[model samples]
Target chain A: MPDSNTNVIEIRNLTKSYGKNRGVIDVSLEIKEGDIFGFIGPNGAGKSTTIRSMLGFLKIDSGSISILGMDSVKDHTEILKHVGYMPSEAWFYGDMRVSEVIKYAADVRGLDCSEEARKLCERLKVDTHKKIKELSLGNRKKVSIVCAMQHKPKLFIFDEPTGGLDPLMQKRFFELINEYVAEGATCLLSTHVLSEVNKYCKNAAIMREGRLTMLDSPKIDDETFLSFYDDEG
Target chain B: MKTILTKELKLNLKNFLIWSLVVGGMGFVCILLYQSMETEMADMADAFSNMGAFSDAFGMSTLSIASLKGFFATEVGTVHGLGSAMFASILAIGILSKEEEQHSAEFLLSLPVSRKKVITAKGLCVLIMLVAFTAICTLLYCLAFLIMGEGIEASLFIAYMLRVLLMNIEIAGICFSVSAFSGKNRMGTGIGIALMFYVFDLMGRVVPDLKDYLFIGPFSFANASEIMSEIEPKDSSFIVGIILTVLGVATAYWIYDKRDISS
Candidate 1:
């Protein structure tokens, strides 16, 4: 029988370090089927590190990280098929046009990217004709956002997804998140944008100093959490 | 693998067009320099012989003021050794490093393909680019001779061309190996090639008695005057050079396949 739990992502003692510089230590979490999971942290609080390790972008020192129930280090190639990742920086080839960048990404992902690309571009208001170097920072962020969500991946991994977006675009992005969550797919978004969790996330994992400090539902009052943070700092 | 190789070939073609204009144009000027020499052929040989063992040491035996092929062996060898190797190394290093430098490694690795497959594909691309470059250089050399009313034998020409080809493989292999293991791509190619060139030249001077023994060194390989005129490469040295090339390629693939690429 298939496992009914269907945990899309699971981590147990996930740790990484660069020599003496600690990235993350013993990060353990689980996101079951059909959940909007937010990973929150202050700057340099291991949010990107944990997310990158999940995507097999950085090596862990001594720990286990798994995606789609498969071991992360050993089965990353398999995991990638079902995941859509949006990096915080969104650095792309400067010479590539927005359309070419999307097309190239789709090709790499082993998908017929054209139809889906057109739909995403239209929805995201991305002008594919312009070169990436020519695009404004927010526009570039939009292009990356479109690329990440377009394939309808089984899981979406966005690290600081709204980093350069305006308030208007951020609102539109949240609506898109709601629609994605409704479809019973999973989303793991890493950001400092706390308001987003209150607006959409089912639950969130708060991080500090490369460790998980809190994991709870957004149904808790935001003002109460803010007070707890203010008192601690 | 084939797809990645095709992309690499396309990129190298652009590099080739640019370098050919630079190297080939310089080659034409060198040919003019050879023609303008005031000394007669016999007088040149006599003057070279007076330099004793140094003449043989520097490959002055075949350094005629007359033979255009010999002139090319002397001058073009210097030109291609430094210029072409630098150009090729840049492209080869970029094969793996460029993706990471542009933050595309994570994006590319996220594909369905395995990391091993990516490394293999990129390596194949580098190999193909090196072979294509050798063939083009040989063709251009032959064409230049034919156009200039010189009747060079195709077989002999081809044999000399293979020497140049193998020499490039050695340089490419070293650069590829460095790029594979290195986190910093910029330094790997430039430093790798420059170090190889320096080692060869230094060995030629410092260990004067062992100059012939150090044929495996890149400086010796780059010195085309000696390589072109000699009927057979020093057996052990030539074999060692080939072995080094193999070692370089093997080390690169092994390191790349196993190393953690997350960051």
Candidate 2:
């Protein structure tokens, strides 16, 4: 009984903890369909924690989490089918070739990895035959991005997706996201790049110390922000 | 689960080869022990009457080098069985956390599969590896036995090999459960399980009162180790070991399905 126009992600009073250390607390937000959502937070601000919980990778201490209108914990399999995730600290089999790693992921998802992998590799201009151990960090990030996007997921969730990329590649990455959004795909990105946030995200949520400080459209007070960045450049 | 099992089987085949070589190496060493025992046949005959002290000291009293079946039961087969158990332990400890180590956990878990499905797949992989390792060791031992002209009962030998497989499965469950609860302490979990296994064996030997409580041991079939040596056929511990193994796997699944995967 899901509404067709329901939000892609809905979190209400979600809480998580590790022993006595707090991970995330009292976090509530709703990301609508086709929204390019930017999750802006400092280190240990529970950005990754919230993302993990929504993917059913972490247990909730309290509150509710849903993805594509399905309960994250109870309906995880159904929801994950539509979501493509890119983690901040991505790793692959060092002995495996990039192509093989992508194929392995595609095999797990029951998708045609070869065609999609080739297409993504072409788009990213990344060589897929190199062993993961031989690749630099930025190259590795590119591999992860290609793999995440290959399946044409309805919801794309990226955590520090472009941390190691150069300016040119970063720009290309945004272009890819923008293309997806234009095709009506929903995205949630977590990053420290406020400049990217200014350019890419129409809506953003800022967090501090495991709490939500603001959730609003970047279009708000744009004149003031624009003046600051324009003068600095 | 099928995908996980196939991948695990392929990955561990290399490890299984290494352990099989180690077990074969033990057989080579046993040939030296046998040659020396033959040279000292008179002294060994006198020593044989004092079985209790020898069993207590080396657990080798019941083995007879003169007979091929006993030679295998004591030398090559025993080592192969123990080596297979260690191999199973390593796989169980390494598989789940290895994904995290390689940073593949994020990619793997992101599939259209639930956390429960992922754990189920990993558990299945561990079992498949254990079974495949055990089978390869048994085949190698049988081939060696034929070459050595060891005329052991095929049925009894098969039973013995099956016993090793079950014991290995039980140990794998123990190690896997430890691995599942472990976040950053994966190596610690492996070492802890192995240490506890040895400590339990030591306690069973040192304290006569604890002999009946072998259930407390990390491994259920150390008493069966005595049986493998032909010292005593204590069959009561087998059921307890199997039951505990089931419980351990269930607990591992419960914990893994709910716990967060952190790098």
Candidate 3:
């Protein structure tokens, strides 16, 4: 029942809550195969909530989610095998060297990503010899990027991936993403950066306070990007 | 499963070594000291037995300290039982929760592995460490006995160690359930649970009204004095402990798999 050309990610009336946190309510969206879908929303606008729910991190109160044309909860193991997720703040074993961490991730997925991992380290300027505790925030981000990207997954889900990156590194990060897209990978980029959305995302969903303000807002320029970014869409 | 198992085993090695050394070393030192205290122990055993409620609580009233077996049953047995239980509690209580406490669950669960497999791997770590701790401590005790020029009753010693292992497994299983329910490290609470069980067993031995309900706590079947004396452990307590351990592990899987994991 797994359809390779079906919607890469789909959510229908998803709802979740945690105490007073503004958990996503009735959030729904779909990303087609090979689409660079931007999930643009401010902090606490349910971007991470929706994303986490899709990955089966948070249990939804109602509604459903499916990934790669399979039930998200029922087929979670299968879905994750083809998806590469980079969280907002990546935490790794501090005692391990960067190379060991990469190998550990690869080992978990039963993957041999040595060559790809080496290339990603070089592209991201990651120092493989240093322990994770010794790295700066930007360097840690680079390591997480390699862990998520080295597998060359069919779907890439990055939640605020550029937070600690320098401007140059951020540009290079997009370059890598673009290269992956060219290789037939679908991506879901969750960020509040309007410029990244306008520059890269052909179609984006804007969220405000746990609600989707704009569903699949087509390509827009700087002015319209600002309006949609400000919740004026 | 292999990946998580290897990673957890590697991460937990230092901790396991430290705890094993502390408990096993103390037991070894205590056993070595007993050879020098042999004459005094024969005289003081009477006073200890007469200590009334305190002696009853520690099983000293029933098992004299005049002989090596009695001394081991009353002293070294207490050390191993309480030490291993605490170790099992602390180890299992944090294995799953530490991922969230360290903010690594988001990274770990995001991988291709399922939550069930992750918890199973951690549970296996707790079980393996408990076994290793028991083996090391048992070996240290045997060495101590050799140094003291005493021969242990092999069957009794083996039975005691097996009982201790079962008790630790039960304690660890209970705490494993707690770890799944609590997203944060609760070492203090785990230690508290171990101590509470100790007190329950202690009180159950000293207080007649509580004796019948000893089956509720793990120590009832693991009473060092009873095991050394070849007295059959309360059958009800043994059966209940096994049932609870099964239920505890089952509950852990149910709760951890169903509950939402926060970043």
* C-alpha TM-score for every candidate: 0.89, 0.88, 0.95
DockQ-based class of model 3: high
Clashing pairs in 3: none
lDDT of 3: 0.88
RMSD of each: 3.2, 4.1, 2.4
**Which stretches in model 2 have alpha-carbon errors above 4 Å?**
A1-6, A219-233, B28-45, B48-52, B56-59, B185-211, B214-232
What does the TM-score come to for chain B in model 3?
A: 0.98
* Tens-place lDDT digits, model 1, residues B112-185: 66767777788787777667666666666666665666634566557656665666677677777777776566
Backbone clashes, each candidate: 2, 0, 0
Off by over 4 Å in 3: A1-6, A19-22, A215-233
Worst 10 residues of 2 chain A by lDDT: A224-233
What TM-score quantifies how close candidate 1 is to the native fold? 0.89
The TM-score each candidate achieves on chain A is 0.91, 0.90, 0.91
| Tens digits of per-residue lDDT for model 2, B1-263 | 45655666666677767876676556555644554465565456446535664444234455544544545554555466556666777778876767766677777787786666777877887776667666666666566555655446776667676767777778788777777777543755665665566566656654678767765553445433354554543456677676768887887888887778875
User: Model 2, residue B13: what's the lDDT?
Assistant: 72
lDDT of 3 by residue, B36-93 (tens): 8989999999999999888988878888888788888888888988999999999999
What pairs collide in candidate 2?
A: none
Residue B172, model 2: Cα distance from true site in angstroms: 0.9
Best by lDDT: 3
